[model samples]
Target: MQPHEKVKQYLDTICEQIRYKRIHNELREELENHITDQKQAYIAQGMDEETGTFKAVEQMGDPVMVGTQLDRTHKPKPEWSMIVLTLLLLLTGTFIRLYTAPRETNGLELFYRQLLFTVVGIGLMTLCYKVDFTILGEYSSILFFALAAIIVLLMLVINPVDGRFIYASYPLLLFPALFAGVVYSMSNRGYSGVILCGIYFTIPLILSLLIPNITITLFLTLSYLVILTIAIQKKRFKVNQHHALLLVYVPFIISFVVAMTNNNLIYRLKIVFTPSLAPMGVGYMGNITRGIMKGARLIGQGALPENLQGLTVEQVLPLINSDFLLTYITHRFGWIAFLIVVALLELFIIRAFVLCARQKSVLALLVSTAVTLTFAYQTLGFVVTNCGFYLFAPLSLPLISQSSHYLLVNMSLIGILLSVYRTGHMVHDKRFPEKPDRRPFLTIEDGRIIIDLHLD
Candidate 1:
C-alpha cells in the first residue's frame, strides 16, 4: 500500500462493514481523529512518520471487526413494544367495529372499511419510520409559515364543499408538530424566540376558531402549552427560565380566564360538570351517557337509558363508532371491555413518554413530545365525552375512528412518532441540513464505480 493511502484504506474497510450510511461521515471523522492522535503520539516518542502511521493503524484492531462492533452498537432499533401496542390498539378498534357493533347495523361493512384504513395507516407509519425526523427542525420556518398560509387559502380562499371549512381540522391537527420544529429553530434566540413562537401559535388557534372547531382549538392550545413548557424546562431557551415561562404562560392563563368569563364558555362548563343544567337539550348526550354508564355491569352488557324510548344507545351517541367507542364497548361487552381498551391506550401513551425522554436530540424530543401529547389530547377528549362531559365533545383516536381523514392524519402523526423512535438518535438538526442530501449510494461494479443518488 502507498504511504499516505494506508489510513484511508483502513477507514474505508472499517466503514464498509457498517450498515447505516447516513452516519458514515460522522463516524469516519471521529475514527480519523483518534487515528491521527495515536499517530502523532508515536511520532513524538521518536518513531519515523511512516512507522508511526503504521503502528497507529495496527493498534486499532482488524477493520472488519471494529466496523462490525460499531454497526451493532449504532444500529437503528425498532421499538417492538411500541409496534405491538399499536397493532393491538388497531385490532381492538377493528374488533369493536366488527363484533361489538349492533347486530342490526352494517357491522361487516364497517369492519371491511376499517381494515382498509388500518392497512393504509401501517404503510404511512412504515414510510415515516424510514424518514429523517430531524429535518422537521431545519425547515421549521418555511413549514410553519407555509402551512399557516395553506390553512388560510383552504379555509378562506378555496372554501371547499362546506362554507364552514370543516376540512381544515385535519391539517390543523398537524400544527403542533410543525410548531415543535419552530420552537427548536428559536431555542437559541432567547425571549424573542418565545414571542415569535407565541405569534405563530395563534395561527392554528385562530384558524380552528374560524372553523368554529372548539375541539381543535383546545387541542392546539393544550399541545402548544405542553411544547412551550417542556422547552422552557429543558432550558432550551437562552432566557431566564422563570421569565421565559411567565412570558409564555401568563397570556395563556389570562386568555383562558377571559374566554371563560367573556362568553357562555363558563356556563357551558357548568352544564358539562352538572348535566341537569341543560338536560333536555345541551346536556342531552351527557344525560344519556350517565344513565347508561350507571347501569353498566362488570361483564355482559349494560342497561339502556329509560329515555331511549325506542332507539338504541348507539343511535343516540353522535358518532358511536369513532367518538363514543368506549361508551359503546361498555354497553355491548360491559365495563371489562371498556377497561381493557382504556388500559391499552394508557400503556401505549406511557411507553411513548419513556421514548421521548430517551431521545438524545432536542428536535426529536420536542417533536416526539408534541406527538405524544396530541395522542393524549384525543384520548382524554374521547374519555370525557364518554363520561358525560358533552360540552367538549369527542375527537377521533387513530384506528378507533370511522372517519378516513382521522385515520390518515392520526396515522401520519404516529408515523412521525415512530420515526423518532427509529432514527432519532442517528440525526442531528445542524448536521443534517435542510438541503437535500447529496450522499450517493456507492457500489463497485466489476472494475467500475456506480453512484446511485437517492432523492429524499
Candidate 2:
C-alpha cells in the first residue's frame, strides 16, 4: 500500500474503537497530521518514502492500545462529587429535622415523608443525568408554551384556599423548561433569537402579574436576565447600550418604583426597614425569627426553651420547614452548624458555576448558568431574609428545605447540571467544529515526539 493508504488504515483501526464519533473523527485528523509530519521528517533524514511511512506508523504504537486510551479519556462519566455532595446535604437536612423537630409535632412522620421525597428525587435525578439534556432543546417551544398555559390556567381557575393560592408553587417548577427555551433561542443567532427570548420571558412575567405572585415573578425575571446577559456575552444575541438601558434598566427601575406602592410589597418592606412599626401585625414573624436567633446565642439552648416547651420549632417560627428552615437550623444547631450548612451550599453553587464556565456548547452553558443562578439567588434571598436584611419573599433553600416541590425541582436541576458536565465539551453543531486546542497534548521537541497525554 502507498504511504497515505497505510496512514489511513492505521487511523481507521483506531477510530473503530472510539465510542464518541466526534472524538473519533478528531483523533483521526490529529493522528494523520502527526504521522504526516513525522513521515516528512524521516524523508528529510534520507529515508525512502515507504520506509519513512513505516517508521511514522510504527511510532504511533499499537492502534488498539491508542484507541483504548483515547476511549477512556473521552468517555462520559457521572459527576460523582456532585452526587456525593447532594447526598451529604440530604443527610444533613434529615439529621437536622430529626434532631430539632419536637416529638409531639409528628416529627417522625415528617422524616419518613421527607425520606420518601428524597428517594423519588434521587431516582428522578439519575434519570435526568442519564438522558441527553440537549433533547430538551428540540422541544423547547412546546415545553415553554405548555408551562405558560398551565400557569395561566391555574391562575384563572384556582382560588385562594387558606389565604394562599393553591397553585402558587407550580411556577417554581417552570424554571428548567424555561431554561431549555432560553438555550434553544439563544443558540439561534440574530434578531430572531432575541424575539424568541422575549416571547418566552413575557409568558411567565404576565402570568406572575396575573397571579400576583411577586416572588415567582422576581425569580423568573432574574433568571431571564442572567440568560440574556450570557446570550449577549456569547454574541448569540446583540444589544447596544441604549437598547439595554431602555429595554432592561429602565423597566427594572419602573418595576421597583411600582412595587413600592404595592400594599403587600410595602408591608414586607416595612417589616424589613421598620419592624417596630407593626410588631404585632406584619412584622410579628420577623420579630419571632430574630428572637429565636438571639435566644439561641452562641452554643444554642441545647434543647427547647421552657417557654417553647411542647412546641415544635415550626410552631414558633412561621414557614420553619420551608422558607425559614435555615433560620430554624441556626437557632437549634447554633452558629457553627449554620456556618457548615452555608459552606456546603456555597461549595455546591461554586461548583455549578465552574461547570457552567467550562461548557463548550452554548445550550449547555446557558442551562447550567440558569440553574446555578436560580439556586444562588434563592439562597441569597432566603439568607438575607433570615438575617433581617430585607423583606424579600420567602424561598426554600435548595436540597436542604423540606418543601417537596422545591426538593424535586432542585434535584432535577442538579441532574441537569450533571448532564451538562458530562456533555459540556461536545460540539453540537456540525457547522461549528470546536476551536482547535492551542495547547495540544502531543508536541515535538528536539526532533523527538513528546506526548503530554494530560487531559485538561
Which candidate's lDDT is highest? 1
Q: In candidate 1, which residue pairs get closer than 3 Å at backbone N, Cα or C atoms, i.e. clash?
A: none
Task: Give me the candidate number with maximum TM-score.
Answer: 1
lDDT of 2 at 208: 68
Could you tell me how far off, in angstroms, the CA of residue 220 lies in candidate 1 after the best superposition? 1.5
Candidate 1, superposed: residue stretches over 4 Å from native: 1-9, 46-55, 100-111, 149-163, 309-311, 425-456
Q: What would the per-residue lDDT of candidate 1 be over residues 352-372, giving only the tens digit for each residue?
A: 999999888888999999999
Candidate 2: residue 295 lDDT (0-100) = 59
Tell me how many clashing residue pairs each candidate has.
0, 0
Per-candidate TM equals: 0.85, 0.75
